[model samples]
Target chain A: EAGVTQFPSHSVIEKGQTVTLRCDPISGHDNLYWYRRVMGKEIKFLLHFVKESKQDESGMPNNRFLAERTGGTYSTLKVQPAELEDSGVYFCASSQPGRGSPLHFGNGTRLTVT
Target chain B: GESVGLHLPTLSVQEGDNSIINCAYSNSASDYFIWYKQESGKGPQFIIDIRSNMDKRQGQRVTVLLNKTVKHLSLQIAATQPGDSAVYFCAEKGISSASKIIFGSGTRLSIRP
Candidate 1:
Protein backbone atom coordinates (compact mmCIF):
# COMPACT_ATOMS: atom_id res chain seq x y z
CA GLU A 1 0.00 0.00 0.00
CA ALA A 2 1.13 3.52 -0.75
CA GLY A 3 1.99 5.73 2.20
CA VAL A 4 0.99 9.34 2.58
CA THR A 5 2.62 11.58 -0.03
CA GLN A 6 3.33 15.31 -0.08
CA PHE A 7 4.02 17.59 -3.03
CA PRO A 8 6.92 19.97 -3.59
CA SER A 9 9.19 18.34 -1.02
CA HIS A 10 10.87 21.70 -0.65
CA SER A 11 9.61 25.22 -1.31
CA VAL A 12 11.24 28.59 -1.11
CA ILE A 13 9.37 31.89 -1.30
CA GLU A 14 9.89 35.53 -0.44
CA LYS A 15 8.28 37.19 2.51
CA GLY A 16 4.77 38.55 2.00
CA GLN A 17 4.23 36.01 -0.75
CA THR A 18 1.69 33.21 -0.72
CA VAL A 19 2.47 29.50 -0.50
CA THR A 20 0.40 26.41 -0.60
CA LEU A 21 1.34 22.86 0.55
CA ARG A 22 -0.46 19.75 -0.53
CA CYS A 23 -0.91 16.34 1.14
CA ASP A 24 -2.43 13.11 -0.15
CA PRO A 25 -3.46 10.74 2.60
CA ILE A 26 -3.41 6.97 2.47
CA SER A 27 -6.36 5.30 0.85
CA GLY A 28 -9.35 4.31 3.00
CA HIS A 29 -8.25 6.54 5.81
CA ASP A 30 -10.91 8.95 7.02
CA ASN A 31 -8.83 11.05 9.40
CA LEU A 32 -6.23 13.50 8.16
CA TYR A 33 -4.06 15.80 10.25
CA TRP A 34 -1.63 18.63 9.58
CA TYR A 35 1.42 19.42 11.65
CA ARG A 36 4.38 21.79 11.47
CA ARG A 37 7.82 21.94 13.02
CA VAL A 38 9.94 25.05 13.12
CA MET A 39 13.67 25.05 13.68
CA GLY A 40 14.63 23.74 17.11
CA LYS A 41 10.98 23.23 18.01
CA GLU A 42 8.78 20.20 18.42
CA ILE A 43 6.16 19.31 15.85
CA LYS A 44 2.82 20.93 16.54
CA PHE A 45 -0.63 20.18 15.30
CA LEU A 46 -2.27 22.56 12.84
CA LEU A 47 -5.69 21.05 12.13
CA HIS A 48 -7.62 17.87 11.44
CA PHE A 49 -10.07 16.73 8.82
CA VAL A 50 -12.55 13.89 8.89
CA LYS A 51 -13.98 13.09 5.51
CA GLU A 52 -14.13 16.67 4.13
CA SER A 53 -15.28 18.15 7.44
CA LYS A 54 -13.03 20.10 9.73
CA GLN A 55 -12.74 18.13 12.93
CA ASP A 56 -10.37 20.30 14.89
CA GLU A 57 -8.52 23.46 13.90
CA SER A 58 -7.62 25.01 17.21
CA GLY A 59 -3.93 24.57 16.50
CA MET A 60 -3.98 26.86 13.47
CA PRO A 61 -1.54 29.69 14.08
CA ASN A 62 -3.49 32.65 12.67
CA ASN A 63 -6.05 33.87 10.22
CA ARG A 64 -3.48 34.10 7.44
CA PHE A 65 -3.28 30.32 7.40
CA LEU A 66 -6.02 28.34 5.71
CA ALA A 67 -6.51 24.55 5.39
CA GLU A 68 -9.03 22.69 3.35
CA ARG A 69 -9.73 18.99 2.75
CA THR A 70 -12.00 18.68 -0.24
CA GLY A 71 -13.87 15.39 -0.67
CA GLY A 72 -11.74 14.01 2.23
CA THR A 73 -9.13 12.49 -0.08
CA TYR A 74 -6.49 15.21 0.04
CA SER A 75 -5.69 18.36 1.99
CA THR A 76 -4.04 21.68 1.27
CA LEU A 77 -2.63 24.30 3.60
CA LYS A 78 -2.32 27.86 2.32
CA VAL A 79 -0.44 30.68 3.91
CA GLN A 80 -0.96 34.17 2.52
CA PRO A 81 1.40 37.03 3.08
CA ALA A 82 3.85 34.59 4.49
CA GLU A 83 6.26 35.87 7.08
CA LEU A 84 9.80 34.83 7.84
CA GLU A 85 8.56 33.14 10.96
CA ASP A 86 6.27 30.95 8.87
CA SER A 87 9.17 28.89 7.55
CA GLY A 88 9.02 25.31 8.72
CA VAL A 89 8.43 21.69 7.75
CA TYR A 90 4.78 20.82 7.20
CA PHE A 91 3.78 17.19 7.73
CA CYS A 92 0.59 15.34 6.89
CA ALA A 93 -0.70 12.20 8.57
CA SER A 94 -3.67 9.90 8.29
CA SER A 95 -5.24 7.19 10.40
CA GLN A 96 -8.24 4.94 10.51
CA PRO A 97 -11.26 6.04 12.52
CA GLY A 98 -10.53 4.70 15.96
CA ARG A 99 -9.44 5.86 19.36
CA GLY A 100 -6.00 4.27 19.36
CA SER A 101 -5.19 3.98 15.67
CA PRO A 102 -1.61 4.81 14.68
CA LEU A 103 -0.95 7.74 12.32
CA HIS A 104 1.00 7.26 9.11
CA PHE A 105 2.94 10.36 8.09
CA GLY A 106 4.45 11.76 4.92
CA ASN A 107 8.00 12.94 4.28
CA GLY A 108 6.75 16.55 4.72
CA THR A 109 7.23 19.77 2.78
CA ARG A 110 10.05 22.07 3.82
CA LEU A 111 9.08 25.71 3.34
CA THR A 112 11.69 28.41 3.49
CA VAL A 113 10.59 32.04 3.60
CA THR A 114 13.22 34.60 2.90
CA GLY B 1 0.03 26.06 28.84
CA GLU B 2 0.64 22.33 28.45
CA SER B 3 3.96 21.10 27.12
CA VAL B 4 6.13 18.02 26.74
CA GLY B 5 9.90 18.09 27.06
CA LEU B 6 12.92 15.84 26.88
CA HIS B 7 15.75 15.66 29.36
CA LEU B 8 18.53 15.59 26.79
CA PRO B 9 19.02 16.98 23.33
CA THR B 10 21.28 14.15 22.22
CA LEU B 11 22.63 10.79 23.31
CA SER B 12 25.53 8.67 22.12
CA VAL B 13 25.52 4.98 22.90
CA GLN B 14 27.59 1.96 21.99
CA GLU B 15 26.09 -0.49 19.58
CA GLY B 16 24.44 -3.50 21.27
CA ASP B 17 23.90 -1.46 24.43
CA ASN B 18 20.53 -0.40 25.71
CA SER B 19 19.41 3.19 25.20
CA ILE B 20 17.00 5.04 27.37
CA ILE B 21 15.43 8.42 26.57
CA ASN B 22 13.42 10.33 29.13
CA CYS B 23 10.60 12.84 28.75
CA ALA B 24 8.46 15.02 31.02
CA TYR B 25 4.99 16.34 30.38
CA SER B 26 3.21 19.17 32.18
CA ASN B 27 -0.35 18.18 31.50
CA SER B 28 -1.82 15.95 34.14
CA ALA B 29 -4.91 15.44 32.07
CA SER B 30 -3.02 13.61 29.37
CA ASP B 31 -3.99 9.96 29.26
CA TYR B 32 -2.22 8.64 26.20
CA PHE B 33 1.53 8.73 25.61
CA ILE B 34 3.39 7.79 22.43
CA TRP B 35 6.92 7.58 21.08
CA TYR B 36 7.97 8.36 17.51
CA LYS B 37 11.17 8.06 15.52
CA GLN B 38 12.11 10.54 12.80
CA GLU B 39 15.01 10.15 10.44
CA SER B 40 16.55 12.87 8.33
CA GLY B 41 14.24 14.08 5.56
CA LYS B 42 11.31 12.01 6.81
CA GLY B 43 8.35 12.53 9.06
CA PRO B 44 7.82 10.86 12.41
CA GLN B 45 7.05 7.15 12.53
CA PHE B 46 5.21 5.53 15.38
CA ILE B 47 7.36 3.48 17.74
CA ILE B 48 5.08 2.50 20.57
CA ASP B 49 2.38 3.78 22.89
CA ILE B 50 1.08 3.32 26.41
CA ARG B 51 -2.07 4.43 28.14
CA SER B 52 -2.18 6.17 31.50
CA ASN B 53 -3.82 3.13 32.96
CA MET B 54 -0.75 1.02 32.27
CA ASP B 55 2.61 1.80 33.77
CA LYS B 56 4.62 -0.15 31.22
CA ARG B 57 4.26 -1.61 27.75
CA GLN B 58 6.68 -3.51 25.56
CA GLY B 59 7.07 -3.88 21.83
CA GLN B 60 9.44 -5.96 19.75
CA ARG B 61 12.62 -4.57 21.25
CA VAL B 62 11.33 -1.34 22.73
CA THR B 63 9.71 -0.62 26.05
CA VAL B 64 7.77 2.42 27.17
CA LEU B 65 7.39 3.25 30.82
CA LEU B 66 4.94 5.85 32.06
CA ASN B 67 4.94 7.34 35.54
CA LYS B 68 1.79 9.33 36.19
CA THR B 69 2.84 10.64 39.56
CA VAL B 70 6.02 12.20 38.28
CA LYS B 71 4.64 12.96 34.84
CA HIS B 72 7.61 11.19 33.42
CA LEU B 73 7.93 8.93 30.38
CA SER B 74 10.80 6.88 29.12
CA LEU B 75 11.62 4.73 26.09
CA GLN B 76 14.10 1.90 26.32
CA ILE B 77 15.62 0.30 23.26
CA ALA B 78 17.40 -2.98 23.66
CA ALA B 79 20.61 -3.76 21.76
CA THR B 80 20.63 -0.38 20.09
CA GLN B 81 21.72 -0.75 16.49
CA PRO B 82 22.97 1.69 13.89
CA GLY B 83 19.63 1.56 12.20
CA ASP B 84 18.09 2.89 15.42
CA SER B 85 19.91 6.21 15.08
CA ALA B 86 17.27 8.89 14.76
CA VAL B 87 15.39 11.57 16.64
CA TYR B 88 13.06 10.11 19.24
CA PHE B 89 10.07 12.14 20.37
CA CYS B 90 7.67 11.66 23.21
CA ALA B 91 4.14 12.93 22.79
CA GLU B 92 1.06 13.19 24.94
CA LYS B 93 -2.64 13.40 24.16
CA GLY B 94 -5.09 14.74 26.66
CA ILE B 95 -8.38 13.03 27.20
CA SER B 96 -10.38 16.05 26.08
CA SER B 97 -8.07 17.37 23.37
CA ALA B 98 -9.77 15.42 20.58
CA SER B 99 -7.13 14.20 18.12
CA LYS B 100 -4.46 16.75 18.89
CA ILE B 101 -1.17 15.24 20.06
CA ILE B 102 1.44 17.45 21.73
CA PHE B 103 5.06 16.56 20.98
CA GLY B 104 8.31 17.26 22.76
CA SER B 105 11.62 18.41 21.41
CA GLY B 106 13.18 15.20 20.14
CA THR B 107 16.28 13.51 21.53
CA ARG B 108 18.77 12.59 18.87
CA LEU B 109 20.27 9.13 19.32
CA SER B 110 23.62 8.35 17.79
CA ILE B 111 25.09 4.86 17.90
CA ARG B 112 28.83 4.18 18.15
CA PRO B 113 30.02 1.03 16.47
Candidate 2:
Protein backbone atom coordinates (compact mmCIF):
# COMPACT_ATOMS: atom_id res chain seq x y z
CA GLU A 1 0.00 0.00 0.00
CA ALA A 2 1.13 3.50 -0.72
CA GLY A 3 1.97 5.73 2.22
CA VAL A 4 0.69 9.19 2.88
CA THR A 5 1.94 11.80 0.44
CA GLN A 6 2.08 15.57 0.77
CA PHE A 7 2.34 18.08 -2.03
CA PRO A 8 4.86 20.81 -2.85
CA SER A 9 7.31 19.33 -0.29
CA HIS A 10 8.32 22.97 0.23
CA SER A 11 6.52 26.27 -0.24
CA VAL A 12 7.50 29.91 0.02
CA ILE A 13 5.07 32.75 0.25
CA GLU A 14 5.34 36.43 1.03
CA LYS A 15 3.59 37.85 4.04
CA GLY A 16 -0.18 38.34 3.66
CA GLN A 17 -0.38 35.79 0.87
CA THR A 18 -2.52 32.70 0.76
CA VAL A 19 -1.10 29.20 0.48
CA THR A 20 -2.71 25.83 0.22
CA LEU A 21 -1.10 22.56 1.30
CA ARG A 22 -2.38 19.21 0.11
CA CYS A 23 -2.23 15.76 1.70
CA ASP A 24 -3.16 12.38 0.29
CA PRO A 25 -3.58 9.72 2.88
CA ILE A 26 -3.22 6.02 2.47
CA SER A 27 -6.01 4.24 0.72
CA GLY A 28 -8.82 2.91 2.90
CA HIS A 29 -7.69 4.87 5.89
CA ASP A 30 -10.55 6.18 7.91
CA ASN A 31 -8.90 8.99 9.82
CA LEU A 32 -6.82 11.86 8.50
CA TYR A 33 -5.01 14.38 10.70
CA TRP A 34 -3.02 17.58 10.25
CA TYR A 35 -0.09 18.58 12.40
CA ARG A 36 2.74 21.06 12.25
CA ARG A 37 6.16 21.69 13.73
CA VAL A 38 7.55 25.16 13.95
CA MET A 39 11.31 25.62 14.02
CA GLY A 40 12.71 24.23 17.27
CA LYS A 41 9.24 23.38 18.53
CA GLU A 42 7.55 20.08 19.10
CA ILE A 43 4.95 18.85 16.65
CA LYS A 44 1.42 19.94 17.43
CA PHE A 45 -1.92 18.73 16.14
CA LEU A 46 -4.10 21.06 14.13
CA LEU A 47 -7.22 19.09 13.35
CA HIS A 48 -8.62 15.74 12.28
CA PHE A 49 -10.95 14.44 9.59
CA VAL A 50 -13.04 11.29 9.52
CA LYS A 51 -14.22 10.90 6.00
CA GLU A 52 -15.42 14.24 4.55
CA SER A 53 -16.43 15.70 7.88
CA LYS A 54 -14.39 17.62 10.40
CA GLN A 55 -14.04 15.70 13.61
CA ASP A 56 -12.13 17.95 15.97
CA GLU A 57 -10.67 21.31 15.07
CA SER A 58 -9.84 22.59 18.53
CA GLY A 59 -6.17 22.50 17.70
CA MET A 60 -6.50 24.94 14.84
CA PRO A 61 -4.32 27.96 15.43
CA ASN A 62 -6.55 30.77 14.21
CA ASN A 63 -9.45 31.73 12.02
CA ARG A 64 -7.23 32.35 9.01
CA PHE A 65 -6.51 28.66 8.73
CA LEU A 66 -9.06 26.39 7.10
CA ALA A 67 -9.08 22.70 6.15
CA GLU A 68 -11.27 20.72 3.80
CA ARG A 69 -11.60 17.02 3.03
CA THR A 70 -14.17 16.92 0.33
CA GLY A 71 -15.39 13.43 -0.58
CA GLY A 72 -13.28 12.18 2.32
CA THR A 73 -10.50 11.16 -0.04
CA TYR A 74 -7.72 13.74 0.43
CA SER A 75 -7.29 16.84 2.54
CA THR A 76 -6.30 20.43 1.87
CA LEU A 77 -5.15 22.99 4.42
CA LYS A 78 -5.32 26.62 3.39
CA VAL A 79 -3.72 29.51 5.18
CA GLN A 80 -4.80 33.02 4.27
CA PRO A 81 -2.83 36.18 5.02
CA ALA A 82 0.06 34.03 6.11
CA GLU A 83 2.32 35.52 8.67
CA LEU A 84 5.98 35.01 9.43
CA GLU A 85 5.07 32.84 12.35
CA ASP A 86 3.19 30.48 10.09
CA SER A 87 6.41 29.17 8.64
CA GLY A 88 6.82 25.56 9.61
CA VAL A 89 6.51 21.97 8.42
CA TYR A 90 2.94 20.86 7.98
CA PHE A 91 2.54 17.08 8.30
CA CYS A 92 -0.35 14.92 7.21
CA ALA A 93 -1.03 11.63 8.91
CA SER A 94 -3.61 8.88 8.63
CA SER A 95 -4.62 6.02 10.83
CA GLN A 96 -7.06 3.16 11.18
CA PRO A 97 -8.58 4.58 14.30
CA GLY A 98 -11.20 1.90 14.42
CA ARG A 99 -8.95 -0.58 16.20
CA GLY A 100 -6.45 1.84 17.77
CA SER A 101 -3.98 1.54 14.94
CA PRO A 102 -1.03 3.92 15.01
CA LEU A 103 -0.83 6.86 12.63
CA HIS A 104 1.32 6.96 9.51
CA PHE A 105 2.87 10.29 8.49
CA GLY A 106 3.85 11.90 5.22
CA ASN A 107 6.99 13.82 4.32
CA GLY A 108 5.23 17.11 5.09
CA THR A 109 5.09 20.50 3.44
CA ARG A 110 7.71 22.91 4.65
CA LEU A 111 6.17 26.37 4.40
CA THR A 112 8.27 29.48 4.55
CA VAL A 113 6.65 32.87 5.04
CA THR A 114 8.68 35.98 4.48
CA GLY B 1 2.70 17.83 33.17
CA GLU B 2 2.18 15.86 29.89
CA SER B 3 5.19 17.34 28.11
CA VAL B 4 7.42 14.88 26.29
CA GLY B 5 11.17 15.43 26.46
CA LEU B 6 14.43 13.81 25.46
CA HIS B 7 17.48 13.33 27.65
CA LEU B 8 19.77 14.74 25.00
CA PRO B 9 19.21 16.76 21.89
CA THR B 10 21.63 14.48 20.01
CA LEU B 11 23.28 11.11 20.40
CA SER B 12 26.29 9.46 18.77
CA VAL B 13 27.11 5.76 18.68
CA GLN B 14 29.31 3.36 16.80
CA GLU B 15 27.83 1.06 14.20
CA GLY B 16 27.08 -2.52 15.33
CA ASP B 17 26.74 -1.28 18.89
CA ASN B 18 23.47 -1.12 20.76
CA SER B 19 21.87 2.33 20.90
CA ILE B 20 19.65 3.60 23.64
CA ILE B 21 17.74 6.90 23.58
CA ASN B 22 15.83 8.15 26.54
CA CYS B 23 12.67 10.24 26.81
CA ALA B 24 10.76 11.81 29.69
CA TYR B 25 7.09 12.66 29.61
CA SER B 26 5.02 14.59 32.17
CA ASN B 27 1.56 13.31 31.57
CA SER B 28 0.31 10.70 34.01
CA ALA B 29 -2.92 10.41 32.15
CA SER B 30 -1.13 9.53 28.92
CA ASP B 31 -1.71 5.84 28.42
CA TYR B 32 -0.64 5.49 24.80
CA PHE B 33 2.87 6.32 23.60
CA ILE B 34 4.90 5.86 20.43
CA TRP B 35 8.47 6.34 19.23
CA TYR B 36 9.05 7.78 15.78
CA LYS B 37 12.30 8.00 13.83
CA GLN B 38 12.55 10.79 11.30
CA GLU B 39 15.37 11.00 8.80
CA SER B 40 16.58 14.26 7.32
CA GLY B 41 13.88 15.85 5.14
CA LYS B 42 11.46 12.99 5.72
CA GLY B 43 8.43 12.49 7.84
CA PRO B 44 8.55 10.62 11.11
CA GLN B 45 8.31 6.85 10.77
CA PHE B 46 6.92 4.73 13.52
CA ILE B 47 9.39 2.45 15.26
CA ILE B 48 7.40 1.02 18.12
CA ASP B 49 4.75 1.88 20.62
CA ILE B 50 3.89 0.93 24.19
CA ARG B 51 0.85 1.43 26.30
CA SER B 52 0.67 2.15 30.01
CA ASN B 53 -0.53 -1.41 30.47
CA MET B 54 2.79 -2.83 29.30
CA ASP B 55 6.24 -1.84 30.40
CA LYS B 56 7.92 -2.93 27.20
CA ARG B 57 7.10 -3.72 23.58
CA GLN B 58 9.42 -4.98 20.92
CA GLY B 59 9.59 -4.78 17.15
CA GLN B 60 12.13 -5.78 14.56
CA ARG B 61 15.33 -5.06 16.55
CA VAL B 62 13.60 -2.15 18.29
CA THR B 63 12.10 -1.98 21.74
CA VAL B 64 10.04 0.64 23.51
CA LEU B 65 9.69 0.90 27.25
CA LEU B 66 7.14 2.90 29.11
CA ASN B 67 7.17 3.61 32.83
CA LYS B 68 3.96 5.23 33.84
CA THR B 69 5.03 5.66 37.43
CA VAL B 70 8.03 7.74 36.45
CA LYS B 71 6.47 9.21 33.34
CA HIS B 72 9.39 7.97 31.28
CA LEU B 73 9.89 6.23 27.93
CA SER B 74 12.89 4.93 26.05
CA LEU B 75 13.84 3.34 22.74
CA GLN B 76 16.58 0.76 22.29
CA ILE B 77 18.03 -0.38 18.98
CA ALA B 78 19.99 -3.57 18.85
CA ALA B 79 22.86 -3.92 16.41
CA THR B 80 22.55 -0.29 15.52
CA GLN B 81 23.55 0.47 11.95
CA PRO B 82 24.48 3.61 10.03
CA GLY B 83 20.96 3.73 8.65
CA ASP B 84 19.69 4.19 12.21
CA SER B 85 20.94 7.72 12.21
CA ALA B 86 18.01 10.09 12.38
CA VAL B 87 15.95 12.18 14.73
CA TYR B 88 14.06 10.09 17.29
CA PHE B 89 11.05 11.53 19.00
CA CYS B 90 8.76 10.09 21.64
CA ALA B 91 5.15 11.13 21.54
CA GLU B 92 2.43 10.83 24.12
CA LYS B 93 -1.06 10.43 22.79
CA GLY B 94 -3.63 12.87 24.06
CA ILE B 95 -5.98 11.18 26.44
CA SER B 96 -8.25 14.19 26.12
CA SER B 97 -8.66 13.70 22.39
CA ALA B 98 -9.36 10.80 20.08
CA SER B 99 -5.84 9.45 19.67
CA LYS B 100 -4.18 12.79 18.94
CA ILE B 101 -0.44 12.36 19.40
CA ILE B 102 1.89 15.13 20.63
CA PHE B 103 5.53 14.84 19.65
CA GLY B 104 8.71 15.84 21.46
CA SER B 105 11.43 18.17 20.26
CA GLY B 106 13.33 15.10 18.91
CA THR B 107 16.86 13.72 19.39
CA ARG B 108 19.20 13.44 16.47
CA LEU B 109 21.05 10.14 16.44
CA SER B 110 24.37 9.89 14.63
CA ILE B 111 26.20 6.66 13.83
CA ARG B 112 29.94 6.36 13.40
CA PRO B 113 30.93 3.74 10.87
What TM-score, over all chains together, does every model reach?
Answer: 0.96, 0.94
Clashing pairs in 2: B2-B26, B2-B27
Against the unseen true structure, what C-alpha lDDT does each candidate score? 0.93, 0.89
**Against the correct fold, how does model 2 do in TM-score?**
0.94
Classify candidate 1 by CAPRI docking class.
medium
Write down the worst ten-residue block by lDDT for model 1 chain B: B93-102
The weakest ten consecutive residues by lDDT in model 2 chain A span: A94-103
Error of 2 at B113 (Å): 2.4
Off by over 4 Å in 1: none
Cα lDDT tens digits, model 2, A45-95, are 899998888988988999999999999999999999899999999999999
Evaluated against the true structure, the overall lDDT of model 2 is 0.89
Candidate 2: lDDT of B91?
Answer: 89
| Model 2 steric clash total | 2
Candidate 2's C-alpha runs over 4 A off are B94-97
